[model samples]
Target: MRGLLLKLLFSLMLCLFILGTVLTAFVWYVFNYSDDRPRSSSHPIRKNPEADPSGVCKECRENTIDKMVEIHSHTWKKQEANFKKFRSQLTSRCHGATKAIVTQVNTPLESKIVYDGEKRKPLVVTPKLFSTFLKEQPFKNVTWETCAVVGNGGILLNSSCGEEIDSAHFVFRCNLPPLDKGYEKDVGNNTDLVTANPSILLEKFEGLMEHRRPFVESLSSYRDSMLLLPAFSYGHNTPVSLRALYTLQDFNSPVQPIFLNPEYLQSLARFWRAQGLRAMRLSTGLIVASLALELCTNVHIYGFWPFAQHPHDRRPLTNHYYDNRQSKKTVHAMPAEFAHLLRLHGQGVLRVHLGQCASGPR
Candidate 1:
């Protein structure tokens, strides 16, 4: 009986080992070798000249490249002209109001501050210095006003939006995730600023330095146009990855760092509180810092909804993006704030483009 039991135990262990090995291999294959083709055969393939011009035959490829270049150059010139006009309009309307608003919002907060362990200091520009920075060198000739904000929706795949997104005077991307593999066709190579809060940097980079190489390689494709934004407070987010990113200047594509003044944040918070809308004040610091980039002109926003919407329907969620999926009862939605954004867009305060979705969340 004892001999029989020992044999059975050995057989069970062998089976378990085989199962684990097979599962590991399957995961590795999925992550490393999966193709970008649609999972279902029912989905039809759309012909995109930029993605695959072979449909037109190989001989005309040179013509296609030349046409793309010519189109980009013309669009760039037109965008510059529009940006200058937009800046003039903005200055005429809001130049005085903005300063008064900033002063009114200014409040002192007794909060401790911390920085990532990286050696570079934050790039905090005073109003005058920021304006000067925008006016100098490369920007003197290049106009960077009105911008179109693009999101990473799969809907944008083969949607003929690459040129439209690129036409923006300044384009913004958050989290700086790679556009390689599955996303290359969606997010083309024309990103201007890579935005992040310190928390995002810390979470993605700390203790995961091995991941940095691929991220850096993807970003190197846009070396000349990387803009980094700092978090407002340690309390909002205190991620170790932020420090890791700061230390990664050795990566081929180093980002130009920009810091937000804590005072600006405190002031914004005070203003929101005075309005009796303290709950909506959490991200005010980020908003104020972003607005200050009016010096850069033609600011457009993307992927900045307060909450994630349905993956297919693009409806807003009541809970946060990272919330547990199993807990259905606890989830709640916030449409009022989204309505406010629409109102602001209508007032020309900011341009907010919704991703293509047939319905919004109820």
Candidate 2:
């Protein structure tokens, strides 16, 4: 009877010990893992710098790269913590690293490229045109530590971001904007890749069918930068794209003209559409920024403001840093695209510089 009593007492003590262990674990989890507790230095509140209610763009004005990652909010803290996951979530659909441009490998001689603008019209890869394609993607098997996508917004007129922009491992520009002509200090002279719209060829150089010297001379400033053209985006873009390429070849210019793959573009459009971007077409700035997000470990976008007033000082601005010629609003949803970029900035996936840049290497 004494042995039975001792066994019962031992069993009761064991139950109490098990209950005590479970309670201790519950308390530990509440204190250590609960959101109410203070986050470590590694995780921060993912706040939108633009949406800061204080009227001061404190986070946006930071000159140092380390300071740029400080603005966060609770909603995006998880995304801010896992950049690789965010990048994969964004790029896995478009695959810009492998398929951003047309290559002989990606576009075989007989394959057809459906125009993104006119879905019914498709351009077959003829042997003559296939010869112009690079053997592989220029960005294939390459990743940059940092990248800069420079837009033409007039907010950059005197931002003095050149030194910082030039410091990036790779730089992307849109619409073949002039890099020289005293604009280098603000816009930078380094151009790893620049996009030229077909309309620019038709309007600026008379389709490159006449005064080819001026066209060739204008391209001299790019200095071996790969020129990307939307050759198959629309049916009308094909001739001018080809003309621009042929002109470069005829002059033996160092600037290499490449074609934007329509397939990749379509995929990108679908990706953006899934993200709630409904526009007639994605702007050049957004396209390059998205590409940068995929190719670079750290992506910084400059001059992306779509407003008429300065983001900081509320001063009037031009449509572009180089010229005030306004764009056709019906084509692109600028505000909507900027909203998406702003969200990405909030999530710590990328940094969007709306005001003047800090004058130095970043």
Score each candidate by Cα lDDT: 0.44, 0.83
- Residue lDDT tens for model 1, 132-213: 1212122223444565454443335433445455666666564464555544444555766665555545555553345667
Angstrom error at residue 255, model 2 = 0.6
TM-scores of all predicted structures: 0.46, 0.77
Clashes of 1: 9
Clashing pairs in 1: 105-267, 145-298, 146-298, 201-241, 202-241, 202-242, 315-361, 318-332, 318-333
| Candidate number with greatest lDDT | 2
| Candidate 2 per-residue C-alpha lDDT over 1-362 given as tens digits, one digit per residue, 9 for 90 to 100 | 99999999999999999999999999999888888877888988777765788755644443321232243222333254556876786678989978999999899998988898998878888999899898988888789988889999998888888888999989999998988888898889888999999999989999988888898898777899989999989999998899889989988999999999988899888999998999989998889998888888888888887766665556788989898998998899987898788778787778777666675434
Q: For candidate 1, what is the TM-score?
A: 0.46
Poorly placed runs, candidate 1 (over 4 Å): 1-143, 150-160, 182-185, 207-215, 229-232, 235-246, 270-293, 296-299, 304-337, 355-362
Task: For model 2, name the residue pairs that clash.
Answer: 45-72, 45-73, 46-72, 46-73, 47-72, 47-73
Worst 10 residues of 2 by lDDT: 65-74
